[model samples]
Target: MSSLSGRTAVAGIGATEFSKKSGRSELRLAAEAVHAALDDAGLSPADVDGMVTYTQDANQEIAVAREVGIGDLSFFSRVHYGGGAACGTVLHAAMAVATGVAGTVVCYRAFNERSGRRFGQPDARLGGEPSSQGLEMSWHVPYGLMTPAAWVAMFARRYMHAYGATSEDFGRVAVAMRRHAATNPAAWFHGRPITLEEHQASRWIVEPLHLLDCCQESDGAVALVVTSAERARDLRRSPAVIRAAAQGSGAGQMMMTSYYRDDMTGLPEMGVVGRRLWEQAGLGPSDVQAAILYDHFTPFVLTQLEELGFCGRGEARDYVAGGGIEIDGRLPVNPHGGQLGEAYIHGMNGIAEAVRQIRGTSVNQVRDVRNVLVTAGTGVPTSGLVLSAG
Candidate 1:
């Protein structure tokens, strides 16, 4: 295991209500979540010495700290690549705490994506800017590959062709996520589980991708408190020990438009992250009692399972068939409903779910959850974490 492994722990997690419209400012949402996390950890904002968040988040670290009444910060950082930065924020926080650079760090993400700037909508400005990111999108925007669904659809189609998988295979993932969500009162889709047939009949967002296959555009915020493992053991909640945390960017990476890769059938970047996570934790797939794999899109979930070696390549279809990913199955997944059933706080909520499972407080808690695997976004430079009971 790496020197950083088990040195830090997630002692607290907090979130605003998941909703389609959270009528508050993004900054307010951030403050609320951060304050809630500190409260959950039995710490005050004055105790926070560091902060981390996504680059895409509108709330600045200093601004959030000021609003939350936090004092001088010794460390502050932001990660890029949209949802891919979810676990990366925690990774940054863990490193800071492990190295004694900071005593307590609050990692947060807050956005009114649904009520404010919806990421699902295509904007021509993406290709009009002179920045490096605009240059990357220029090649695809002109070809009508605009929205996130469009970008993922191209890869999903290729994956289907390579593996002879059907759309129903993807729908099964949606069904399972919704089923789990139905039981979670905090989920937006609570009490709304759907059948595979319902998924097939859902309107199409893009060819080879149903509306149900895509995650919800949610308005919410989530935050986590990271402190040294020793200190965490003294906190209010059971520490979710940071077993491993890693980020990876594969060759030929081009954001979501990574079609140039020779094989579009898998997420090699996630594979890189997976290998590092297991190595750092000195654990394998069998050690993971549950998984909160990112569900921005259903197709990517299958690729992530394969990338992490839970199954052979192109075998996720059969692996997820029946109730394999349910709470009673071999590997329960997204028991908190995931982005599909829960709100999409850019994979932050998924990490919260992992923590809940480790603490044995999850609504869909699995039995003997010694280790829980949580992954960030796919089809991009992604990150992952292996959280264990402390």
Candidate 2:
């Protein structure tokens, strides 16, 4: 087992309300989330000695500390990539805690994705930069392949041709996620369940991807507090032990689109992370009671299942059919409605849902959820986690 396994646990999770417009600055949102997470952990700002966030986040770590009343921090770090860095943030925190670099660590991400800098629209920011990622993206942006949906659609089309998967199959995933979100009052889609027909009727953003298939352009912030397993267990509230956490970049990896790979049908990066997570946790697919697979796009949800060993290489099309991913299905996924139905605060909110499943506090709680799998963004260098009961 990895030394990080069972060494650190998530003692608290907090988030600003998932919304279309928060009307607050991203820094304020981060401060609110950080303070709330500390409160949930029964910890004060003075106790935090480390902080982690996405490099894309507008708020600086020291600024967040000043706003949230956090004192001097001995460790601070940032992960690169867009939503792909979700679980990687926790991985960094676990490493810090396990190595005695920090006693208490907070991982947070805050953004006004809808109200400010909508990622769905084609923006010149990436190609305008001097970095290699920008140079790589410059080639595709000129060919009308700029938005994330367009980038993912190239792979989705190939996946269909290779695996015989249909748009209906993808719609089933959308329906299930919205169904779960309908029941979750905290969800943006609360009481707004959609039928598979509704999914089909939604306008197409790109061929093989309906407007409904894409995750929301939400505005929100989420934060989690990580501490030693010993301290977490002693806290008043139950903790979600970090059974395993991993980050991986697959062969021929690129920032958002890696379509040039010989075989672009699968998420090999997720496969790399999945193998490490299971080996670290000493568990496999069958051992997991539920999952919070990233649902940035409905098709990638199917691809993740295949890469993560939930099914055969080309068998996810069959595996996800027949209510296979619902609450009572073989592997209940995204019990909190995921990024599709819930607000997309990157993937941090999904990690929080996994913690809730472990604590038996989720409104869509799974039965005997001793272990829950949570994955970050796909189609890029990504991360995953195996969370177990305290």
Candidate 3:
């Protein structure tokens, strides 16, 4: 295992209520979550000296530090690539704590994705800008491949063609996530589990993709406290040890438009992350008690299972169809409802769920959970974590 493995731990986690509208500024949401995390850790803002967040997050680290009553920070950093940066933020905090550059770090993400700026809508300005990202978007926007759903549909269609996978295969993922969510009171879709028939009948957002397959746009924030493993042992809650955290970008990666790769059916970037995580943690797929796979789109969840070596390539449809991913099955996934049934806080909530499982406090707690796997966004430069009990 890497020297960084199990050196630091997530001692606390906190989140705001998931909703379509938070009725507050993103900064305030960030502060509230941070404060709650500190409180959960039995630490005050005065103890925090490091901060990290997504580069695209509207709330700046310094701004959040000030609002939360934190003093001078020794470490503050940000990761790029939208939802792919979720676990990467925790990676940064673990590195800081392990290296003694910072004593305690708080990783957070906050946004008003629903009421303020709906990411589902196409923005024409993305293609007109002069930056490299804009140049990349220019390759597809003019051809009506502007929205995220359209971009993912291209890959989903290819996946279906390559593996003979049907839309029902994808619907199975939604159904499983909703079933777990229905039992989680914190989930937005609590008490609203759907059947396979319901998933099949949901409105189509794009070919091979349904509205139910897409995650909800939510307004909220989630924050986690990271500190040395030894110190974490004395914290208020059971610490979720940082067994491994890694980020990976595959060849020909172009944000979410990584269509140039030879195999559109797989996410090579997540494969890279999975390899590193397993090596670092000295554990394999069977060791994981549960998983919080990023569920931005159901098709990607199937792809992630293959990339993570939970099953062979082109076999996830059968793997999911045979009750392989249920709460009582081989690998229960998204027990907190995931981004689909739960509100999407850009994967931050998913990380919190991983911590909850480790602490034996998850709403849908799996029996004898000692290790939980959490993945970030796919079809982009992505990240993942192997969180184990301390």
Candidate 4:
């Protein structure tokens, strides 16, 4: 077993209301979310000596620290890539707490993705900086591979062609996520579930990706508090132990559009993440009670299941069919509606849902949630975590 397993735990989680527009600055949103998380953990800002956040996050670590009244920070770090860095923030924080690098750590992501600068639009900010990412974008952006949807569409199309997967099969994922969202009070899609037929009829953004299959362009923030296992016992909420945390970047990995791989049908980076997670946690697919697979797009969720070994390769379409991901089904995924249904606070919302499951406080509660699996974005260098009830 990994030494870090059960050494650290998540004592708190907090978020603002999910919305299309926050009407506030990104820095303000970050500060508000940080304070709320500290409240949930029964921790004062002075208790936080460590901070972690996404590299794409608009609010810097020092900026958030000062705004939240944190006096001195011993550990501060940032993980890169867009939504892929969501779970990684927690992983970094957990490691800091586990290894005695810091006492209490907070991982956060905040942005005005919708009302401010949008990631979906073609970025004019790439001024050819002398960086690896700038180099990768240079080859594709000029060729009109400008947006995330278009980058993922290339693989989605190839997966469909190779496995005979249909757009309707992809729609089933959208239907299930929306169904779960309908009952979640905090979900933006509360009481607004869509049917399978509606998914089929939705307008096409790309050739096999319907508009309904895509996640929302939400603007918000989320935060999580990680501390030692001993300290979590005295916290406000039931602690979700960090059973395992891992980040992986595969061979020949590029940005969202890594078409040069030996097989374009798979995400090797996520497979790399899955291997370390199961090995470190000493658990398999059967031990997991639920999951919060990243759902930036519906098709990627299916791929994540296969990559993470929840199901065999090319079998996710069938695995997810027949109510497989519903509350009463085999492995309930995204019980809090996920990015497709919940507000897209990046993948941090998914991590919060996993914590709720272990705490036995989720709206769509599952029985015997001893272990919960959570993953970040699929396309690029990715990350995963196994959260469990201590």
Candidate 5:
């Protein structure tokens, strides 16, 4: 476990233009992002010996490798779950490079989510498969918990009821993310910051969940290059060392609908990952100057802060209330705008932003960022990483 830490680092980060519609194939989006990352790393396609991506990614490893004109591959892997697989892709790639399984592994995720299949729209097919996912979906999808928003709303409403949090509290997160996005040229919401009043005025997707609470159904891609930290130090860009990476499935977990838990106030899966991350990195929440928390929905951001030990349980509402997550605050979160203000290529984009922060080149750069905490989707079996400057 210790061998994985500081052994591998992200040498490059790249992404396609985030938009509602990319007007291209998912494969093309992936290829473009991969090519860009490899170029940023000063590496050629032939140098890539490993590849990792989400299982949900339509652009398979072999397919994208061929498109990029890569030769043989020593490693190829895919992680399960939707957005939860984001950081796992990098974790798998890092494992490959650290253990001498492969060198120069590329991790990517791409999709035409808006123009093609919108995940927000409920489809019965989600519960029809004969696997564990299907079995889990059967428990919630049949009870009007169909879409991602609905699955989240179940726990969200519970969270609100438990913690006395209001819609306004969630709106603050949206406002903050958009505020950061306004200056980020690559953000889908760039130059269009929103107000809390606008967030409260938005239509309801579910009870207690306004439209503003949801993340974008974006059409884009993100790619990262991972290699030995020693090698990355000599690459085109400064390396963001992989201090720690972890994945967790919580007690009584059922995808996004973990309703059976005795207390639904915090994200146990995230806590599991958070503990492992701190132990592996030899650091704690206070060490991170910036964070890229998965903001698929705003409420989970609060819960994650608690679970990650950034704040005490049920103290996140106050923790974020005083602009604690701003660029100059205690922990500047989602400087790339997150899934809410930035485009959601799942959480791949968040990981890319963490790398940039470590390189001291983010659009909303934090001051003297020594360690950056990046989290994948919450509520479900999730993943996270602790990145440091190399």
Candidate 6:
């Protein structure tokens, strides 16, 4: 087995309040979140020597390090593909620490997506410039596939068809998320849980996709502190050991829309990550006591359950027919409300929740969260990690 397995752990996780508007620069959010994570780990900025984030992150590593008063950075890296890059950030940081490239590493993502950039809006380009993404947009945007919701709807429709799922099945995911959010004080939707009836009654954003099915477009930042497994024992909190981390890209993958694939009902990339995770961790799906499956769209949650071997293909609907994803279910999912009801920190928040579960600190804490499986965005090349109590 590689030294990477059980070599590093996420000793600290911190995030800002999930909100519609942060009312601050993304750089400041990034710096604040990094500082919070360091504090949570009982470390200071001076202790950090490595940083990792998404390629789309505006705050550069050097800039964040300087703002946070870190002396120097020996390692820094960026992952791509929007929300799919969340877990990959920690993977790179863990590798850095496991290999002695850096003593202490921080993985973070901060964005004023809702207030500043407004990712929900359909723009001609990311920054009104022409590039490869622009080329892809050119083909779809002109055909009414402009917004993220519209793009994800195509796959959601296909998933519903292939699995014989109803709109109410998707509503169950939203209801569970809102229930978790209702209890989480840091959640923007705190004390605002919704019922399945409410979810079904919500207006439709796209055909076969209700408004509640889509994830929130909020502004916030989340960070994780990574270090060697030995050092993590000295940290402030119990370590959430990085049992396994893997990133995978399927054949003919695209940004949000990968319509050309032969199999559109499942996320093949997640399957790749899942197989490697289970192998590296020496644990199967049965060993996972809880999960934080990415919920960029409610349908993707069901598809992920199938792809990650939690259930058979086209059986996620029956698997989730009851309130199985709730706190007392067979496998509690999105115990932190997820991006659907909490806030979308580009899937970084989901990783934080997984750490909370392992540490037995989640508001909707499962009875015995020995191992928690966390995944990044779906319908694209994705990433996953298996976290265990250290």
Winner on TM-score between 4 and 6 is: 4
**On a 0 to 100 scale, what is the lDDT of residue 342 in model 5?**
85
User: On residues 217-272, what C-alpha lDDT tens digit does candidate 1 reach at each position?
Assistant: 99999999999999999999999999999999999998899988899899999999
**If scored against the real structure, what TM-score would every candidate get?**
0.99, 0.99, 0.99, 0.98, 0.98, 0.97
RMSD of 3: 1.0
Model 6 misplaced regions, further than 4 Å: 126-131
Lowest lDDT sum, 10 consecutive residues, model 2, at: 122-131
Q: How much does each candidate deviate from the true structure in C-alpha RMSD?
A: 0.9, 1.0, 1.0, 1.2, 1.0, 1.4
Candidate 1: Cα lDDT at 291 = 98
Query: Model 2 — TM-score against the truth?
Result: 0.99
In candidate 2 the C-alpha lDDT for residue 238 amounts to: 92
**Per-residue lDDT for 1-390 in model 5, tens only?**
245888999998988999998999999999999999999999999999999999889998999999999999999999987889889988999999988999899999999999989989989798898798898888777877798887787788888888888888888888889889989999989999998899999999987789999998899999999999999999999999999999999889877888889998888999999998999999998899999999999999999999999998778889888788877678899998888988888999999999999999988888899999999988778899999996
List model 4 lDDT by residue over 148-171, tens digit each.
Answer: 888898999999998888898888
Error of 3 at 230 (Å): 0.7
Q: Write the per-residue lDDT of candidate 3 for residues 93-137, one digit (tens) a residue.
A: 999999999999999999999989988898978799869999999
Candidate 5, position 285, lDDT: 89
Weakest lDDT window of 10 consecutive positions for candidate 4: 124-133
How many clashes does the backbone of model 6 have? 0
Question: How high is the CA lDDT of each candidate model?
Answer: 0.95, 0.93, 0.92, 0.90, 0.90, 0.88
TM-score of model 5 relative to the true fold? 0.98
Residue-wise lDDT of candidate 2 within 110-172, one digit each (tens)?
999999989899886768886898789988987878999989998999999998899999999
Model 3 residue 316 distance off true place after TM-score fit, in angstroms: 0.4
lDDT of 6 by residue, 1-390 (tens): 355789999998888877888899999999999989999999998899999999989999999998999998899999998888989998999889988999999999999988988877877654344687776566688776788888888988888778688898888988889888889888888899998888888999998899999988899999999999899998899999999998989887788878888978888888889998998899999999999999988988998898899999988878877888887787889888999878999999999999999999988788878999999978767788999997
Give the least accurate 10-residue stretch of model 1, judged by summed lDDT.
1-10
